[model samples]
Target: MKAKLGISPIAWWNDDLPELSDDVSLEECLRQSRSAGFTGIEKGRRFPDDPTVMSSILKMVNVALCGGWFSGTLVNEDIATNKHRIQPMIDLFKAVNAPCIVYGEVGHSIQSDRSRPLATKPVLSDADMKAYARRMTEFGEWCAGQGMPLSYHHHMAAVVQFEHELDTFMKCSGEGIPLLFDAGHLAFAGGDVLRVIDNHHKRINHVHVKDIRGPVIKALDWRTQSFLDAVALGAFTVPGDGSLDFGAIVQKLAGYGYEGWFVVEAEQDPRKNPPLRMAEMGYAELMRVTTKAGYVVEAPTFPWR
Candidate 1:
């Protein structure tokens, strides 16, 4: 199957840290995305909540709506509470024709924290881990039934960030919960990207393809810097411009027969990197690598029913 290329608006107007590009308009985000050869876009803060409004706006740029992040508080809340929180978004998603919702556990996440470092982020005990897994799996199953598949996102400041946590979650999660394979975050958390793809590709329903600046990562007092602090300093970057091996990663995905959006998402300051230029660079390198891996990059379309 052919792969689709999309880009997130976070590069233009970050939702977590709006101050990053608070002035960049949603119109410019989609326009630059189209200019950069992306056929789809993930949601950002400025994006219209009304599906009709969003669809009409995207039509001008000829970009499809890929998916958007859905913050889940299931670690501290029950499945019902989390489901209620996500249902409204799922309703809007159906109208915009999004394939899935990117589920991120933010109950104890410090991805947006600036005062405290990432090292002091949240941790779940053994029982809490099991409870989270059960709730997420149940919620994910419900989401799929609602035509909005849940693609769980693992981040650097979340309880599910480490290899052991991720493996446990994957082991406990039923078939309803699918992995949102994010190469950059996996690498940022010090995990092997290819190894993760080899293990979880079967359960992957979505993908986020980004690169990291190794020097910046190495220079960081990792225990002291927050995820947002790293972003402010340009820790993440487009694939070819950074140290990540996109060719090997794409080859591995092809081997797994992965089919979905290879969404280019590098959370960098738009003023310095220029979202349009970075998007173009990311798209070009992804195309080159995927093609060499015997994959075709195509226009975006809804995959989940």
Candidate 2:
């Protein structure tokens, strides 16, 4: 099946949220995203929190509600707290008619705190994984009732950063909960994107198609800086400008029968590269890569390249 292309509003919100400026309003962001050839957009917290309002705005823009990121501290936080955090987002998804909610580890680590003295160590232990799995099972059941799916986002700096962590999380996660494969984040965290897809293609429910500069990634590693620090330094860029092998990765995802949004999520400075320009470049590259991989390309209604 052909997958739809979408852009994450988080890209604009990075700078837009701090300014609280009129320029980055939800309506404006959606307008720009649609004009930039994106069929859908991922919701950000800065967007309207009220589902009805958010849905109405999206309907007006002719944009679909692609799934979005939600902060979940399942590893360290208590089950009650986690449940409370998850239910509202799930309700929002149902209200907006979004198929899924992308989740990631938040707050504390599941690994030993000593692994990275400066940063929070991953807290995802075997016991913690089991508890998380149970919580996920409950969440999945809740999502099913709402006609939505919960796709866990394995992130860098989070508990499931590296390949081993991903393996553990998958092995311990609830049976039906799907995974959100983010290629750039996986590469930044020192995991092979294609390998991960090859090994666990069955679990992927959605994907975040981000690309990063190879040398920047290496330099960031050499400095041992934080992920946010790297972002501030311009580690990510439009797909073709970066070193990632998207042609191979897209083909792998297709082989697995994956049918979900390919979200362009390059978190960079808008001052350096305006939102519209970045979107244009990224959207074009996405089409090129997907087309090169032998996937049927959909003609975008908005500006592309």
Candidate 3:
């Protein structure tokens, strides 16, 4: 399976906290992404809404437009309303020729709640899980009809974060709702990455290859700090700098025939972890790992790069 490396703009500008990289420009983001040997970019709030303008900006640095995080309210709202909320992003994805859209169900999540501790993340009852799964399936199928796949992102403070929670959600949801395998989030939740791969590799259509500092994670007071608090404390880092065994992870992904963008997505403070340097570090490490796994990092026939 061939793979391409992509870097998320969140390293430059975070979505949850706009003040993180407030000084960085869009031109800087794209330039650094390409300079770091990335062929694609997972856009964030700093990205333009106009597809034509977005394309022109990214084209300047040979960076293809990859998907970004999309927050969904399926568990609390109607499917039609949810579709309406995401249609603009769908339109943007279509115009940019992106592969798929990464969706995180954050209707009741405390991931962004700086006032509340992450340990207080919302939970669903058995009946609520079933309802949420059904809604997710129906909406994901609708997204598929628009020629854009919706890979459900299991986030730390979201409804489906743990391994068992994901198991239940995926088992109950329709086939249209694929999984977005994010290594950092899984490790942060104390879930096994390989275990998820062994169980749900067939349904994984997108990947977020982020690494985490185990000590920072071990010191995190999820009972007293929010997700952003941990981020502020340097909980996440680039691939090779952290404790994740990404080489082994890549080998497992290759064995499962995973073909798509391996997005380097880690939400870190740009002031402490410079975006360009970390992007290069992540690219170098991922290139080494993917090459060892028999996959070449090459540019696909996309709109740009």
CA RMSD for every model?
A: 2.0, 4.4, 1.2
User: For candidate 3, lDDT tens digit of each residue in 7-91?
Assistant: 8888888777876774778898788888999989886887898998988987787778877888888878889998998999999
Top model by lDDT, which number?
3
Error of 1 at 120 (Å): 1.0
Per-residue lDDT for 162-215 in model 1, tens only? 877888888877888999998888888889898888788889989999899988
lDDT of 1 at 35: 87
Q: Please list the C-alpha lDDT of all candidates, in the order they appear.
A: 0.86, 0.75, 0.88
Counted clashes in each candidate structure: 0, 7, 0
Which runs in model 3 stand beyond 4 Å of their true positions? none
Looking at model 2, report the run of 10 residues with the lowest lDDT sum. Answer: 109-118
Ranking by lDDT: 3, 1, 2
TM-score of each: 0.96, 0.87, 0.97
- Considering only N, C-alpha and C atoms within 3 Å, which residue pairs clash in candidate 3? none
